[model samples]
Target: MIEIFTDGASSGNPGPGGYGVILKAGKYYKELAEGFRKTTNNRMELLAVIKGLEALKKPGNEVTIYSDSKYVVDAVEKKWVFGWLNKGFAGKKNSDLWLRFLQVYKLHQVKFVWVKGHAGHPENERCDQLAVKAGQDRQRHQIDTVFEQEANKL
Candidate 1:
């Protein structure tokens, strides 16, 4: 099984935000993270999972995602996102991220396990640290265009 741990951070609710993802597959491990100029915490949360799944090399691989976002995990497990889709994501906050998540979610046998934020899970703790660090990183933030565009429209 390919196991992943993910977390997201925002300086403020809609301030600069970022995500961290750690992937463990047997003896191989990788970490991914990036900062966004302007985005919500939930967007970072969902984007972390979407980007992690997109990083997979092959379809049909078993994937287990551990995340700190009930917003992300419950939406899938409780089938709320599908309902949102049927409603055209009406009154939704993160439709773009939801669609992006569904696109990658269907490519694999995926399972989501919700972990409490700031808990003692090693990978989850590390992801939180990484996400915090990412939010503070002052490097180029051009990768936030999609998020910025949406923020502008709001």
Candidate 2:
């Protein structure tokens, strides 16, 4: 089984954002993080999970993801994302990421466990630190083109 711990942070609602992810399986471990020039926290939250899953070298592994974002955990645990997909994702945000998520998601057996943020969970706290640090590093931040393009239309 693989365990993933994830966190996301943004300075503003749509400001610089970043996601942190830690993947652990047996005696192996890995950490991932990246910053976006402009993006929402929810995007980062979902992206963390996506990035984690994408890191798996082989499919069909059982994955348990720990996250603080209700927006992500609830949507999957409650089957909201399936409904959204069936309805063509109308009126839904982050459809791009969601679609990408579902693709990688189908390749694995996935579960989500929600944890309270800043509650001293070791892995969660470390991910938060990585996310916050990445978000603060303006120089290395990459453009979230999909998000920026969609935001421009609003």
Candidate 3:
């Protein structure tokens, strides 16, 4: 089984956000992180899971994801995303990422485990560090075009 640990951070809500992901299977391990010029903590949180799932090269793998975000864990585990999808994601945030997540998500046998953040869990703490550092690195930050455009429409 593959295990993924993820975390996200933002300097401010909808400001300088980033996500971190750690993927492990047996002895193989990988880390991924990226910063966005502007975004929300929830966006970063969901995106971290998306990124980790997208990293898998093969389909139908047994995967378990560990995240601190109830926003993500509950949505999936409680089957809320399915309801949102059926309703065309109206009045929902992060529909774009949610759609993208569903695409990759269907290819795997996936499960989620909620972990407490900043409680001294090793992998979770590392992910937090990666996310924070990435968010702070202004030079390498990428534009979150969808989020920016949506915000502008408000």
Candidate 4:
């Protein structure tokens, strides 16, 4: 079984943002994080989960994900994402990321647990710190092309 703790933070809405992910399996542990020059909190949150799942080396593992993002948790837990997938993600905000999520998601048995942000959960707090620091670290930032293109459309 594997446990994943994730968090995403933004310096401002649609501003500098990043995601932090902690993946643990038995005695092995890994931390993953990356920053984007422009993105929303929700996008970062979703990307955190995506990146974590993408890192899995093998399929069929039992994975438990802990996150504070209602946008990501509720959509998956409530079965809303399935409906969106069926309809080709019509009218969806982050269809690209959602599609990416479903691709990796199907490879494992996954569960999501929603936890309160800034609460004292050790791993969660660590993820939050990683996310915030990454967001503010200009040298580590990369362009979020999907977000940038969407913003151009508006």
- In candidate 2, position 74 carries an lDDT of 99
lDDT of 2 by residue, 68-99 (tens): 99999999999999999999999999999999
| TM-score order of candidates, top first | 3, 2, 4, 1
Model 1 TM-score, 2 decimals: 0.95
Candidate 1 vs candidate 2: which has greater TM-score?
A: 2
Q: lDDT tens string, model 4, 55-74?
A: 99999989999999999999
Model 3 scores a C-alpha lDDT of 0.97
Q: What TM-score against the true fold does each predicted structure earn? A: 0.95, 0.99, 0.99, 0.98
Off by over 4 Å in 3: none
Worst 10 residues of 2 by lDDT: 129-138
50-74 per-residue lDDT for model 1 (tens digits): 9899999999989999998999999
Candidate 3 total steric clashes: 0
What digit string (tens of lDDT, one per residue) describes model 3 on residues 1-154? 9999999999999799899999999999999999999999999999999999999999999999999999999999999999999999999999999999999999999999999999999999999999999999999999999999999999
Kindly give the stretch of ten consecutive residues in candidate 4 with the minimal lDDT sum: 131-140
lDDT of all predictions, in order shown?
A: 0.89, 0.96, 0.97, 0.95
Model 3, residue 62: C-alpha shift (Å) = 0.3
What number of backbone clashes does candidate 1 have, counting pairs of residues 3 or more apart or in separate chains? 0
